[model samples]
Structure formats: C-alpha cells, structure tokens
Target: MRVRNKPWADDLITENPQAIVLNPEHYRGQWQSRFKSVQPLHVEIGTGKGQFLIGMAVAHPEFNFVGIELQKSVLAAALKQSLPAELPNLQWVLADGQGVNDFFEPREVTQLYLNFSDPWPKTRHEKRRLTYKSFLKSYAEVLGDGGQLQFKTDNRHLFEYSIMSMTSFGLNLTELSLDLHADVAASQGELENIETEYEQKFAAKGQPIYRLVAQFPKK
Candidate 1:
C-alpha cells in the first residue's frame, strides 16, 4: 500500500520547503528553530499520507508538530494536504524511524506518536517492531523529561507483545485499551482521540483498535 517510485514526488516535496524539510539530516538539533514559537515538540514517526499528524496539528495549535515519513511518494501526499492548511506550527521531515537519535539532540522531543505502526509479526523480525527494547532505547535518548509515547494498532498479538516489552524494559504504561471503540469503561472518558487512516479503515470493518501510552521514569 505504498508508492515507492513516483517521479513527481520528490519535486513536490522540494518545492514546498516552507512546509517540508527536504534535508532533514542537516536540521538534526535545529528542529525547534523552524517553528513559530518554542513550544513543546510532538513528533509522529511513519506518518503515512499524514491524516493523524494533520489532524493533531490542527486540533492542538499550542504544541509544535513534526511528521516524519520514510517514503518520498507517501510524504508527498501528506504535504499536499498539510500545505493548504497553512499551519505555522506544523512541519514535515523525511526520515527513517531507525535513526531517530541521529535526527534529534538528546531529550529534544517532548512527545512521540506511533499510529498503526508495522507489527513486524515474526519472531526473527521482532527488532523491527517500533516498541522493541532497542527502539525504546532510541526513543529514550531523544524524548525529553515527562515525555511519553502514544501508540495505536489493530494487531492483537503485537499489542500484547508491546505490553510485555514495555514491562520488561522498565517503561511504565500509563494507559491502555484493548478495544478502543467497544470497551466503554476501559477507554475511560473520551480521550482526545484523532483517527489515523488505518484506524478508520479497520474500525469501519468492526476491528477494535488497541492503544497504549508508555514512558520511562527518570531515576
């Protein structure tokens, strides 16, 4: 479900320098300077076509938002939607999640979002999972004090694995819901919920979205 090779994609991303960062590696620690004010920074990794990031930026104007996507063609589609919104506090970057530490300074980001991330549902490929201990270490290096990672997925096995991973890694889970739509009491009151493209698609087909927020406490 990804367009890997689109000739026009790079050009669109390059042309919209105001909204998207064509050279994200150079901006590593200078992420905050690109935004209007020095607000708490929130980042979404694997921002596919960007429905979630765009909705988050529009809803919470107080926080600075960054959307990072690996695919140029996919990011191009995201840029197409965000540019016309004309949001000052929103920015996009082309990046791979595996290299988050290289992209930002220590404790640079205040919040992280993982919306419908790839489950990587194989025993040998467990390291590729976003919530893996190795990935959590990378996240801890960049996430600032009191920072937390919010996650949502439709995969039950992945969700269970994530919960176990968080516990073993000494990361605390603040909230969790195995069935976001159906489990009324477990979801607790309405969370400031924003639907990602995958969430919407799965929910329409009667699939329950699993969600959790985890953080590492300062010792």
Candidate 2:
C-alpha cells in the first residue's frame, strides 16, 4: 500500500477538521456526539486508502464509523476521498492502534475491524502484529463484553497466528472463512463482504482471503 507522497496532504487534512478528527481522545466516551445520530460505533484499524470504511459508512448509516490510520499521507488520502460524500456518520483518526483505549471508553465501541494489516511475519516481530495479545487487550477493553472483532487478511500465516492469539486470549470465534470470495461466489453475492483496495488487489491475483469474526469474552 505504497502511496506517492501527496504534497497537498497536509493542506487537505488541515482544511477538513470535521471529517479528520485531530483530537480524537477528546471525544472519548462521547463519539456519538460527532455523528448526526446516536448509534453503534464501529472502528477500523489500519484503514488504508478509505475504500472499505467509506463503503461501510455508506452501506450502514445506522452505525457510526471511525477509521484509525497512523500514516499521515494515507489518512489524508482517505480524508480527500471522503470529502465529496461528506458522510455524517464517518470520521478519521490519525493515530496508532495501540492507543485505542485512550481514544474510547470501555464498551464504547460496538465492533472493530482489521483489514489487510501488516503480517509482521518474523517471529521476533510478533508483538508488532495488530492481532498480538497486547493489542488484543486494548481491543477487548475498548469493546468490552460481547463486543465483536472482525479480521480479514490475505496472509495465511497471519490469519493462523491471529486465531491462536485471540483464542488464547479468551476471545470467542463466531465465524471464519479460509476463502471468503469463494463463499461469496457460492452464495451468489448474498453474503455481505466489503472489499478493501488491498483485498481487491490480492483477490485479483487468485489469493484466498481469510476472514474471522471474534467476540470478547462475556463478563
């Protein structure tokens, strides 16, 4: 997901204060206030280029969507792409996923999404993976009991590692698919699956997309 440095990225981000929330921590426990209506809050970590999140926002207006991306240029791209829509239920945060607990109150988020995140394949770099136990702790705290976490990745090793990490951390796996597109095609497009830019690209190369839906353990 290499994007050419957009020279106007800073200017674009500076111009859109409402859509690109610079002070996300200030909205802790009150995320609904930013939206047109109070509803369930859904967040996507590593929300690269914004296609998946924008589509989700459009399709599920009933839920508030927040995309957190650490890369400023990438976040700016998302901001620029979302400008035309001016979606009231959508917003962007330029921050690291590790600080998720600082951005939202416990149980404030209804669901979380991880799409095509860096696998960090090396054993020594396991902690850097978004699905690592440390990251899962933040996710669980922010989501609380019965909160859902959906992860999608084309990396088989990452998917497998995530399954073990999450389950060992006491999360419950509700749904899983080794080949998501195959199921989608089998279902005749009845299954609801959003395709991210990376997802589309990987799928185009005949890669099997792995996806899983997990829930935080009940109190």
Candidate 3:
C-alpha cells in the first residue's frame, strides 16, 4: 500500500548516524544512552502511519517508545507527526522488524505491541506472520524477562494462531478480549486509547477487536 497523502514524510528519516543503530551489536551496554535513563522501552513493530505509537508515547510520557516501520514513506509520515510534538520519550527507526534482535540487547524492551499486523492469509506466507514461532523467538530474546507482548487484530484465524503460538513459546497469557469496546466497560479504568490506523477503521465498522497480553517467562 503506497502512501498517497503523505505530507510529513521527510521528517521520519534521521540523518544522524548516532541516532540510528542498524546493527544490534553496537547497542550493547550503550543502549541506555539512546533514551535518557532507559525508563522502560516499548517497541511497536510495523508502526503503520504512526497514529498508535504517537498516541502511546503521548499517553505514557514516562516510558520511551520506539516505532519500527520498514516503509520509509509511511515512516516519514509518522516521524512528521512525532517530531512536531518534540516528544522526548518517542523515537523511531526505518528498518525491518525481523532484524529487531540485532539492534536491541537481551531484555532491552519492556513491552512489544503488534497491532493489526499483516495477516498474510496465504498458507505459503505463514512464515511472514509476526506471531509465527520465528518472530516470537526474536521477541523473546529482545524483551526483558517477564515483559509483555500486547497484540490486537481483526483477523480471527490470525488471533487464534497467535494465541497458540504464544502458548507454545511458553509465554503466560493474562488478558484476552474478543471484543475490545464491549469489554472496556468491564475493564474498569485500564482502557488504552486507540493507536493504529486499522484499529480506528475496524472500530468504525463495528468489528470486534481481538486482544491478548502474553508475558515471557523469567529466564
């Protein structure tokens, strides 16, 4: 999907080599310097357009947020929206999410968010799904022990597959919601605001959003 009305695209690409770490080995002990004090980092892989990431960063100013999007054009749009806000807690990178472990140290991230990830419905594309075992292994290595992976999707098959995959990885599941909005009232005050572009669209269509929170066991 090509971005058509991308007004703030250029702003996402950071020319500063210091700010962008393509190789994970270089981050090592110095990763803390990337974000001041390293007060828990949360990463959103495939942060399409930046709506959800931007909102999360704004909502939780205490935690640092990093958005990884492969598409430079859309990444630029996200950057443009984030930069004007001058948010100290928010940062982004234009890179392949499959290589996330290479750029982050063991247990570097506190949380991971996979919102409306590509379903890749075709059987041959199963390997490409973010919740596939291969991707989950990478996330396990990068996320801190006991850290959480929060996922939301409109695809029922993907959601079911993800739950099974997460369980197979030995991750503990805590929260599961088949319909987010309907469960919101019962969830008390723990409702998080909508962040992804697809999330908004799905909500508008009265679709049930499936959500799950899985935690990696302590090593």
User: How good is model 1 by TM-score?
Assistant: 0.93
Ranking according to TM-score, highest score first: 2, 1, 3
How do the residues 1-219 of candidate 1 rate in per-residue lDDT, one tens digit apiece?
Answer: 646777888788778888988677787889988998889889999999999999999999999998989888888889988888899889988878788888888888999999899998889999899999998888888995567999999999999999999889888899888888776544485566888999999999999999999887876
Off by over 4 Å in 2: 1-3
Q: Give the TM-score comparing model 3 with the true structure, all chains together.
A: 0.89
Sort by lDDT, best first: what order? 2, 1, 3
lDDT of each prediction vs. the true structure?
0.87, 0.94, 0.82
TM-score of each: 0.93, 0.97, 0.89
Clashing pairs in 2: none
Better of 1 and 2 by TM-score: 2
Model 2: per-residue Cα lDDT over 127-200, one tens digit each: 99999999999998899999999999999999999999999999999999999999988989688998999999
In model 2, what is the error at residue 158, expressed in angstroms?
0.5
Q: How many residue pairs clash per model? A: 0, 0, 3
Candidate 3 lDDT tens digits, 1-219: 665755445533545433334454566545667776568889899998889988987888899888888886777776766766767777777788888888788888899999999999998999999999999999998896898999999999999999998999899999999998778867686876564789879889989889999999987
